[model samples]
Target: MESIYDEIEIEDFTFDPVLQIFQYPCPCGDRFAIALDDLKDGEDIAVCPSCSLMVKVIFEPEDLEEYT
Candidate 1:
């Protein structure tokens, strides 16, 4: 299996307007979540809720316009 530090495309994630975060499936059956505020602040890492793993989110600044 690949390391949890691997990077994934933004398209692989789903946005939750309520939580204001982006989430992706994790190999550990958990979900990796990154807050929209954090992303807007230039944070690209999403950590898994059930394990010690994180993936670098692939996105651009313009990707956050909808949330603003």
Candidate 2:
């Protein structure tokens, strides 16, 4: 039951330039979010603030260069 909701590519997430965070749609009608810093640190999980659902972000470190 603790497993992730899904595996989503980082490219599928919307990046907020100002907030420097990536977000994806959550089934709870909210969004799952992960900080750019967290991704840079090799963290791959994005969590929904409105629920317990989470997703594993699939991306390579080099893929984040453009966003930086």
By lDDT, the best candidate is: 2
The superposed Cα distance between candidate 2 and the true structure at residue 21, in angstroms, equals 0.3
Q: How many residue pairs clash in each candidate?
A: 0, 0
How close is each model in CA RMSD to the real structure?
A: 3.1, 1.2
> Model 2: how far is 66 from its true place, Å?
0.4
- TM-score of candidate 2 on Cα atoms, chains taken together: 0.96
**What TM-score fits each model?**
0.87, 0.96
lDDT, residue 22, candidate 2: 99
Candidate 1 lDDT trough over 10 residues, lowest sum: 1-10
lDDT of 1 by residue, 1-68 (tens): 43557798888899998888899988999999999999999988899989989999998999889777
Candidate 1, superposed: residue stretches over 4 Å from native:
1-4
| Per-residue lDDT of candidate 2, residues 18-42 (tens digit) | 9999999999899999999999999
